[model samples]
Target: MNLLEYLNQNYLMLVPALWVLGFALKQTPAIPNWMIIWVLLFVSITVGSLTFGFSYEGLINGITAAGVAVLGHQMVKQALLGSGSRKK
Candidate 1:
């Protein structure tokens, strides 16, 4: 599938995955759900008009990358926060 079609078929799973990443950052994060929805709408209208076969590898890659980025951000946030604390 092309980039647009790939995005459309998988965007549902992608947006929420992005949101979870934003939530984990617990700071300022870009790419909110509203933007994601807009992207999906655009893709659906344009590229998503055509349907294609499913791709397990694409799905797995998208989720795994998003998940890893989220975990890494969370780890950094925790470490930074922990370092700034005072102990009794």
Candidate 2:
């Protein structure tokens, strides 16, 4: 019932849930893109610590999870929109 044990058991679910939250927030124009990233990062860390019990490991995991979500979002955006290509 410890935090580490809970994390080990539910990491897969927790990580994706954070990603989905970030992606959804990205659709809102009320906030700037940079703010969105930072907000998601903060939320990820806060959620991880609060839900799993606060610890250094939880903070690191939260940062890693947020980074993964951002990377995934950018990858998908570039892939589907062909945004990586440039025309001159």
Candidate 3:
């Protein structure tokens, strides 16, 4: 099954939007490092809710979008950086 099947088509776009927003936040000195995830979560839910109305699907999609954004970023980062520990 397509992994994105779990999310609404509309929500899929949020994944990359979140990445851009996260990157922008990271560049801003006023935002704290620890708060980025929370900010993303809040934006995700708010945007989802606004797009689809306040409902179960909206909440789920918001949470899922944030997850996909974060997961995708980690996958790319890990691939480029490799494992933290080197083989003996």
All candidates' lDDT scores? 0.46, 0.72, 0.91
Candidate 1 Cα errors over 4 Å, as ranges: 1-54, 83-88
- TM per candidate comes to 0.37, 0.73, 0.87
| Poorest stretch of ten by lDDT in candidate 1 | 44-53
RMSD of 1: 10.3
Runs off by more than 4 Å, candidate 2: 1-9, 83-87
Question: 1-88 in candidate 3: lDDT tens per residue?
Answer: 5557798998988999999999999999999988998999999999999988999989999999998898888788789888774577
Measured by TM-score, how close is model 1 to the native structure?
0.37
Better of 1 and 2 by TM-score: 2
lDDT of 3: 0.91
Pitting candidate 1 against candidate 3, the one with the higher lDDT is: 3
Best by lDDT: 3
RMSD after CA superposition, every candidate? 10.3, 5.7, 2.4
Q: What's the lDDT for residue 6 in model 1? A: 38
Residue range 49-70, candidate 2, lDDT tens digits: 8888788878877777677667
